[model samples]
Target: MYRLFAGIEIPREIGEELQAISKKVTGASWRPIENYHITLRFMGEVDRNTAEDLDHELSLIEAKQMQLTLSGAGWFGSSEPTALWASVEADEDLTRLAERCDRAAKRVGLSLDKRKFRPHVTLAYCKGTPLQEAAAFAEKYGFLKLGPFWADRFHLYSSWSGKGPSRYVSEAEYPLT
Candidate 1:
């Protein structure tokens, strides 16, 4: 079985900007640049046949290119934190594309995500730190916009679970048509 998901790849400049901001959050564990992406769907473990079928179905989706802007910084958990993320400013094109991907995944027999989609790129996962500090940091840097870029493609990625962080590998990339 292979652990897999679908996500959008962030551009290099935006990645670098996020990387710089990540260094400011004193004790939080930052996510590596290569792992920075907004996951569209998380397709847990599956056999080779199912994976191949999912990939083929995903390739048939044709999403128009859209523009995305990283707007604010936020944390996922309330008290004991689970994640730190950069919030994406709302864009209708991005939403439509995400929904298209979600529908395509469902067509391939994967479970649909029940939660309403909110676009954000996770920057880090946190623990043992005062929540106030993280909040303050977010308040300070949240308004720093990382400009804008075109969302022209998305990818199918695979991961391997282990002792430390999971290792992710891209299986295929599907361009917006």
Candidate 2:
């Protein structure tokens, strides 16, 4: 089985800027710069054959390239924060791209994701972190402006869950034209 997702890659300079914002936040595991991406769909575990099917379908997606801008910072989970992320405002091109990815996954027999699509590049995952600390961290770097980058492609990525830094390997690339 393989764990998978589709995401837009972050350029080196933007990743470096995000890396700089990470600091002494207790119980938060800061994601490595290389792992930074704007996830479009999270298609959990699937068998190798199913993964192949999904990849083939995703490659056929025909959409225009998206213009993305990274602005603001926030954390998910209120009382006990679970993640800190840099937000990307929703735009028509981005929304359409996400929807196409969703359609591709569903056509491959993957279950639908119930949650609405909210685009963000996760900075860290907080485990048992205090609420006040999380709130303060959000406030400190709330005005993060990083891009007006063009996303001409997205990738299908594979990852494993365990200790140490999480690394995502791109399994396939799908160009948007």
Error of 1 at 120 (Å): 0.7
- Per-residue accuracy of model 2 over 1-177 as CA lDDT, tens digit each: 999999999988889999999999999999998899999999999999999999999989999997889999989996789999999977888898899999999999999999899999999999988988888888988877888888999999998767898789999999888
Report lDDT (CA) for all predictions. 0.83, 0.92
After the best TM-score superposition of candidate 2, give how far the Cα of residue 136 lies from its true spot, in angstroms: 0.9
Tens digit of per-residue lDDT, candidate 1, span 1-177: 888888898898899989988765656888888888988787878789888988998898887887888999888878766788898899887788778777877876878788788889988888776788788878877797986898889999998767766677999999986
- Pairs with steric clashes in candidate 1: none
TM-score of 2: 0.97
